[model samples]
Target: MTEDSAEYLQRKEFYNRMLTVYGRKPVLEVLQDNSLEIHKLHLADSNKPAAILDDMVKLAKKRGIEVCYHDKQALSRISKNSKQDQGVAADVIGKGFQSHQSFLSSNKKHYRILALDGVTNPQNVGMIIRSACASPINAIILPEKGCAKLDPLVIKASTGTLFRAPILRCKTLASCLKAFAESGADIIGLDANAPHTLGEEPLTGAKVFVLGNETEGLSSDVRAICNKHVSIPMLNNVESLNVAVTASLIAFQGAL
Candidate 1:
């Protein structure tokens, strides 16, 4: 391979090991935390310098982090949430986040991952991430669209676990699950009406537990791809647990 291609591959591999934290305070928090490893710092050129921004730049410089200035549009594109990114973002190379393609390349043969389908509530997403991070679940499959964008609210709701969670981002939940199923992974959809109970699940092989939206449950497209369906056994005629609650139960199921 040419030098440029080799460099590109190296960068890509590095990026797969990182997660981008956007918003001014969140990025700053990650930077201030000495435990975290930052790959690069991005700032929008249009942002007028303030004390916080100045501190960020100085800290990044002191830490020898590569700082790149982009225009508003470019920075928004990098952060993936233009409205809430606050013209700042950083690629954090923590053990938590990764790309699905890179994650699948690992030699691990058995694992449990959580997949969100049309879950638009930031709080729910955050709680799910927190639960997954704390449990034995391998990682969360976050779709690029049709879900809540990772924002400050999500970060807050996750109790700051967003930075330390193993998250795998994909372009689409359905397509990603389909790819996983094709690769001999077990794709299980969480449905309240499913005949199978969560406790009865054997939890074998490489399994992905797909959590649907709060109200509508799984989308037809996503549900159709699941190899099986499972539900939590509830009592007292309670209709169902919140999506996040269900996530917590499923995430910890293997350990129980």
Candidate 2:
């Protein structure tokens, strides 16, 4: 391959591992963590001088991190949330973040993945990440769209476990599930009216347990992709459990 092509591939791989965190306090907290690998610190030119901003700069400089100043518009584009960005953002190298293609390339003998489909609540997403990180689950399949962005609220909810969670990102849940299904992985979905319960059948080999949206459940496209469906048996008149709680159960399904 040409040198330029090689460099482009390298850059793409590098960015696939990055998670941009915005908001002043969140950026500051990320900077404070010594274990995190920060790529760069971003600041808006219009940011009014504050003690916290000064501290952020000091911390970045102390750690020899590159700092870039951008216009408010550019910074907003970088953070993807203008109102909540607070004129600051930081690029954190997520050591555990990777593309699903990368994970498939590894050719592991057996694995279990928790796939989130249209889960928009940031807290739910965070809690799910925490459970998956703490459990025997190999990774989380998080779609870039139709899901909560990795923001400060999610980081807070995860109790800082977001940085360490094995997150496999995709553009769409349906397409990712299709890819996995084609690769000999069982695409399982959680539903309320499914014929079987969650743990009734043996979950062996490559498996993906999908948790749907909070209010709407799974999207039609994602639902169509699910080859198998199972329900979490409810007691009494209870209809269902929260998505995050369901994720915890699925994460620890093997252990129990």
Candidate 3:
């Protein structure tokens, strides 16, 4: 390949691993983290003089990181959440973040991925990431849409595990699942009504346990692609467990 083509591929790979964190506090926290690989610090040009902003700039300078200023509109485009961005954003390289295709291209013979389908609550997403990180799960399939965006609340809820968690991002859960299925993965969905329990069988090969939305379980598109359905059994006439709790169970299923 030509030098320009090689450079483009390298840049694409670098960006695939980067997660842009917005909000003043979140940007500050990321800047303060010396262990993190910060690509750049972004601030709205209209931001008023403030101690925290100054601190962030100081920290970036101390770390030899680049600082960029942009108009409010341009900054919002970078942060994607104009209302909550607080006029500050930072691009932190998530060491564990990559495209699902990258993970599939790996030589690993066996792997388990926990997929979230339309789990919109940031807290729930954070808690799920925490659980997946603590367990034997290989990676998390986080769809870019129909899921909680990675923000301060999610980072806080994960107890700061979001940065270290192996997150495989995709454009849509249904499409990603279809790709996984084509690659010989067993796509399992959690349903309270399924006859089989979560740990009833020992699944081999590539496995993906999908957790659905809080109130609506799985979306119709996601449900249509599931290879099988399993439920977590409970007594006392309990119908179901929270999606986060279910994720925890699935995450630790290998241990149990």
Candidate 4:
């Protein structure tokens, strides 16, 4: 291979990770973490933190991780949610996700899978992953579209659960569920209006718990595919639980 081509090939092996860490707390934490697989760190040149940069310089020196200094404009463009980005970003590589099948079949039934229908919020996605990993769910599934991309916030929120669990991203939620059902996994959806409560249902017999978007619940088409529709019971003024919360309740119930 040509020298430039060889250089490009070498770069591909490193997982490219990025996150907008605003304020001092998260940035300080990341700087202190030696195990973090940071590849490139982008900081605004004008708004420099002399002390923190000093630490980052020392740590990067000891570890040999590269750091990039960028202007505010560049940082803003990279951070989609511009204002919230705390002027710090890091490219920490090292997470590779396996296909859903491998994740499920591995370890022979010690875990459960939580498949999302149309969850859009990265924050919600991260929270669900955190719960899943903490609860130690086997894997997580997200449709390729409409769902949040498995990005940096998610990784940070998951606290590395994104690496631990299998995250399968199918282009279509409906088609994925259809194929999943054919594989003999019972399909269940969470809806406040559903006939059965989550605890009331039998989850131990090869199952997939589906939670939809917060506002829309399950898509009608996806809901139509389910073999069962279960819900969480809410008392008093409560109408429904958040998508992640509902999923955790059902996931824990299904745990062996």
Candidate number of the best lDDT: 2
Kindly report the root-mean-square deviation of model 3 from the true structure over all alpha carbons: 1.9
Query: Which digits, one per residue and each the tens of the lDDT, describe model 1 over residues 82-103?
Result: 9888999998885677777778
TM-score of 1: 0.89
- N/CA/C clash count, model 3: 0
User: Per-prediction TM-score, please?
Assistant: 0.89, 0.95, 0.95, 0.66
* Candidate 3 TM-score, C-alpha based: 0.95
- Candidate 2: TM-score? 0.95
Worst 10 residues of 4 by lDDT: 12-21
Which residue pairs of candidate 1 clash?
A: 96-166
Model 3 CA deviation exceeding 4 Å by range: 1-6
Error of 3 at 77 (Å): 0.6
Model 4 lDDT per residue over 100-167, tens place: 54444443532356889889888889888777766755666777677886665765767766644445
Clashes of each: 1, 0, 0, 1
Q: 137-203 in candidate 2: lDDT tens per residue?
A: 9999999989998888899999999998999989888888998988998889999889899888586
Off by over 4 Å in 2: 1-4
Model 3, span 1-256: residue lDDT tens: 6656968767777888889999998889888877789999999999999999999999999999999999999999999999999999999998799888778888566888899999999999999999999898899999989999888899999988898899998889999999899898889999999999988858567889899999999999999999999999989998878899999988888687
